[model samples]
Target: MKKVVSLLALVMLLNGCDDGNLTQEDINFEDIPTQSCSINNIIYKLKDEESLLLEIPETSFTNEPSTVGEPTLLDINSANRVVYRFYNGTVSATNICETIPPATPIVTDQWSAIAGKIQIFTTAVKTTNATDNSTKITGYNHNIVFKNITFAKNNGTQVYETFPFGDYVTTANALPFLFDQTVEQCSASKQIYNYNSSEALLLDIDPSLIVNSATPLNTPRTGLIGTTVNKLTYRLFSGLLTSGYFCTGTIPSTPTVSEEWVATSGVSNVSGIIEVTTTTLGTGFKHVIVLKNVTMKKGTNDFKLGDSFIYGELLTTN
Candidate 1:
C-alpha cells in the first residue's frame, strides 16, 4: 500500500526470455545474517525479519566475531569489518568500515521490532576534509563497532502491531520467484507427499506480427512462456502482473493464439485452475489475464480498424 516501488525495487526487463542463470542447490542459512553500519543511519528491521528478531535476543545471540571477506559482485562490501553472530547456534558476521574519530562527538540512533533487549545501533564519526587545486573536497567514512557487544534475546510479555493492508503485504518469503519445479516437503518413506504442483506456461503468437512469420516455423509447442513486451498497445495489464508475451513478426501482424496446459488432478499444476486435459493443446493450460489495479495513461492513440494486440483470461472468468 505504501509505495514500495521506491524501496522494494522491481527488476526491469526488456522483451525476451527472462532466463537468469540457474544452478539447483539447497537453500543455505550459512549465508543468512549480514549487517551494514553507516553513521547517523537508523537500521530499520525489514518487515519479514521482525518475527525472527523477537524469537532471538541481545544476550541470547552468540558472538564468534570474525573478519568478513569481500562479497563477490555484492553491492555491499564486508572488508576490514567486525562480524555479529545471530543464529540458532551458528555465528553470522558483518564488517566494520570505520569508527568515530578523536575530538568528534558520537551520535546515537534507534530502531526495533523485538520487545526485550533488542536494540538499534549506530555511530557518527566526522568525515575527513581535504581538497586540492584540481578537486574541491575530501570525504570521510564512519566507523561502527561496540565494545564487547551482545544481543540478548528473551521475552515473557507478548506484543503485536497491526500494519495497514497496503502498507505491508505479508510475504512468507522474499518475492514471487519465476516458475519452479522443485517439490517441497518430504519424508524417509518416499511416499512422494508433495504432488508436484509446478507447471510450465506456453504462449501463442500471431504469425503475421512475428519477424519470421513466413519462415516456416515448427508446430505449437507446450513449453512457451509469457514475457512482457511494452512496445505494442493491447493495454491489458491489471495491477502488476502482465501474463502475455508481446508479438513481433515481419509479416502476420495479427495472429490468433491459444494457451495449453495439463489438468492436474488436485495434486498437480492444473488442480487450482480450469484445465481440460494434460497434453500440449489441451493438457490443461488456459489463457489467464491478472488485473491488479488499473489506471489510464496520459495519452490514447486511436486507429482505424486494425490494431496489434495480445490477450489473457480473467481471474474470475475461469
Candidate 2:
C-alpha cells in the first residue's frame, strides 16, 4: 500500500544518500599542505656577562721517566712557561719538560699552582631557510673572541698578556643547525677539533612552527668543466670552547655537557644532493656530523660544490 512518508524520514534518507560529505577517514593527512616560511637572519652573540673560567690543577704536572710516585713541581719562571691544551673536558700542559719562553711571566710561592684564566667570547650567525622552513638545517658562522688573559700565581701575583688574544672565525655549511618547532626542540653540532670531533648543541624552540628544508651548496663535476652542481654538506669541528649544557626555555641548574663524539656514516651523492645520516647522538639531542666540502669525481672529471646564501634565527627557548 502506498503511504505518505514522514517529512523527517524523507530528510534523513536524503542526508544518508548524499555523497558531498567527507568522513574523517577519507581525509588524507599526507595531502594536507604545510606553510613554507624562513627564519630571519639572526645574530646570536654570547651575552657579554657570560664567561668561562678554566682552572689548572696544581697536580696536573707529573714527573716523567720511570714512575715518580709523586707529582712533579712545575717550574714557575719566565723561561719555563706553562703551555696548556684545552679540550672539551680537561686541560693539560703541552710542554712537559721542554721549557720555552712563557707567553706570560709566572710567579708563584709554590712550585705547583693555578696557572691563569682564558677569557673567550663566542658568537654565531644563524642563516635562513631555502625550502619548507618548518624543518631545516640552518647555516652558521662561529666567531670566538679571545680577550687579554692573565694567569694567577699562588703568591698573589698575576701574569699578564698570554696567547689567543684575537678573534677566530669559522664558517658552517648549509644547515649546520636544526630547529624543529613541532617538537619544541633545536639542535646543532660544532666541529670543535678540526679533523677530530664535534660538539652537540641542544636547545628548545617555539612549538608553533614547522620547517622542512636543507642547507644547499654547489660542487664542480669532474668530467664537466665549469659545470657545478648543488651539493649540501654539514659543518666541521672548529674547536671546543667551554663545557655547558644547551636547552630551551629555562636553563637547567645542572646542565650536563658531554664530550663524546660519534663519527657519521653513509654519506652518499644522490643525484645532486649529498645525503648524510648520523647514528650516534647524545640523549635528548639530535646529533649531527661535521662534513667537509665534497668533490665529485668520475673517471678524470671532478667538481667542487657551492652553496646558496641563506640566514635564519637562533632564539633560545629558555
Candidate 3:
C-alpha cells in the first residue's frame, strides 16, 4: 500500500510538469516581429474653389488619398502669395488664410501660389512582445518631415514658403494580438515654394500688438528692417486699410531725437514702447496715427521686435 501511494504521487507531479505551465525564461521573446513603415511622394493641386485637392499619381504605401486631410494655409508673403501645408490627422493647422477665391485661377492670378513641391516624410517602428498567455504590441519612434523642395522664392514673384512641419510621435500601447497597424501617415502638399531667408520678414510681427483689442486692427506691416540683427521689423497701422492693401514700403530709420516720452517701467518691463506717431499726409486721411518702432530693453541689452505685425483702429472718447 505504501509503494502504491508513492507511485500515485510521482504520477501527479509528472502530469503537472506536462500541463504547459511556463516559466518566464521559457517564453520566446525572439518570436516577436518588428516592422518598419514609410510613405513617400504624394502630389496635390489647387482647385478652382480655393480648396487644395490631393493628387497621388503614385505611392509606395497602401494608404489612399483619403488618409490625407485638407491643406491649410501656413504663411502669406508680402505679394499676397500664400504657402500651404498638409499633414495626417495627427497634426492640426496653426494658421489659415482668410480670403479663399471662388474660381479656378491660374497660379499667377491667385493671391496664394506655390513655387515648388511640398513633401511630407515620416518613419515609425512597430514592436511586438509576448506576455503570459497574451501578446503586447507597441508602435513608437514616429517622426515627420514637412518642408518645401526649395526655400528660395522667385524675385518679384510671390510664392509659397514651406518650413519644417512640426514633429509629433505617437504613444505606445498594447494592441490586439496579430493585428497590423499603421504607425504614421503624413500628407505632402503638391504646392511648392522657393523660399529663402530674405523672404522671412513676411512672417514677422510686433510682439506688443494687441490682437484682441476691443478695437480690431488690420494685418501689421512687416519687412526686413536692417542687417544689424538680421531680423524682420513690424510697424502697426492704427486703422484698417482697403481690401487687398498691405503695408508694403520702406521701413523708416529710428528717430535720433527723443521726445518728452513718458517712461512706464515694469519689473518685467523691457524698453519697447507702442508709440502713436501722427503723419500729416497719408493715403486716404490727412492725419494718421501709425504705430512705429518697437524696441525692448532686456537688462543691458536692447532688442527690436520682429516676426509679426498688426494694423487696427483705437476708439477713444473726445
Highest lDDT against the true fold, candidate: 2
Per-residue lDDT for 206-315 in model 3, tens only?
Answer: 32222222221443322222222112222223233221222334432322111111112311223222322222222321111132333322222222232111222322
TM-score of 3: 0.18
Window of ten residues with lowest summed lDDT in model 3: 183-192
RMSD to native for every prediction? 27.1, 33.7, 27.7
User: Model 1 over residues 1-318: C-alpha lDDT tens digits?
Assistant: 556664444344321333321121221122224333344222212222121111211222211111233111101112211111222221111212245333322212112222212222211111222321111111111112122222222322122221111110111111111433322211222111111122223222222222211112332212211222111112221133221222222312223322112211121222111111111223322232211111111121111111111123211111
Per-residue lDDT of 245-268 in model 2, one digit per residue for the tens? 233345334423222222122134
How well does each candidate superpose onto the true structure, as a TM-score?
Answer: 0.15, 0.17, 0.18
TM-score head-to-head 1 vs 2, winner = 2
Q: What is the number of residue pairs that collide in model 3?
A: 24
Positional deviation of residue 87's Cα in model 3 after best superposition, in angstroms: 19
How many residue pairs clash in all the candidates, one count each?
Answer: 46, 38, 24
Where does candidate 1 stray beyond 4 Å? 1-40, 44-245, 248-270, 276-318
